[model samples]
Target: MPWSAMRRVIDVSGDGGNNSGPPVEQARGRSVAERIVINGLAIAKDHPPFAYAGPVPLEDYYREAVIGGPGAFVVPAEDFNQFASAVRRKMIREMAGLPSRPRMALAD
Candidate 1:
C-alpha cells in the first residue's frame, strides 16, 4: 500500500490459533501500534474429520488474537457449508468500513 494512506488494514482469518507463531497478542499489539486495522473471519466446525473441530473454538481464538483496532470484528462460521456467505458478509463490512457490531455467526 502507499505510504500516504491514512490507515492500513490487514484482514486475517484462519481455522487455527497462534500455534507456532509468536503470541497472538504480540502481533496484534504491533499492528495496533502501526495504526493498522485487523479483522477476523474464523471458520469453525461443529464436528467431523476436519481439524477445525478441536478442543478450542476458532471463533474465540480469533476474537482474542486476530481482531484489533477501531471497529474490528470477528465473524464466525459455525458450519463449513456457510463459509462462503461468512466471507461475503465479512468482506462487505471490511470494504464498507462499517462500525463494529456484536459477533455474528452463520446458522445451519
Candidate 2:
C-alpha cells in the first residue's frame, strides 16, 4: 500500500523550540490536515545547564507549537538518561494508536 494508506505519524524529538524553517505550527497544521498524527519527545537536560530558558517550558513549547493532530501528545525526558525510556513509551503509544489521557495544554 502507499504511504497515505498507512497510519501516518510524525515524531518530532528535540531539545529546543522551533528555531528554523516555516513555523512548526504551520507545518503541523498541514500534516494534520493530511491525517497525520504528530507527537513530541521533549528533551530537557538537567546537567550541563539547560539553555533557551524562554518564557515557555520546553515541553510546553512542544505541546503548543510542535505537536498536533488527533491523539497528539508529548513525552518529556528530564535528561538524556531518560531518553531511551521516554522514546520507548512514545513509540508504544504511537504503535498502539492510544490517545493521551487528560491531555496537557497551556492555560487559556
Top candidate when judged by TM-score against the true structure: 2
Off by over 4 Å in 1: 1-3, 49-56, 98-108
Taking the tens digit of each residue's C-alpha lDDT, what string does model 2 give over 8-101?
A: 7889998887778888889998999989989999998655566647579899999889899888999999888899999999988887885446
- 45: Cα error in model 2, Å: 1.6
Model 1, TM vs. native: 0.75
**Candidate 1 vs. truth: CA RMSD?**
9.9
TM-score of each: 0.75, 0.79
lDDT comparing candidate 1 with the true structure: 0.80
Q: Give the range where candidate 1 is weakest over 10 consecutive residues by summed lDDT.
A: 46-55
Give me the runs in candidate 2 sitting further than 4 Å from their true place: 1-4, 48-50, 98-108
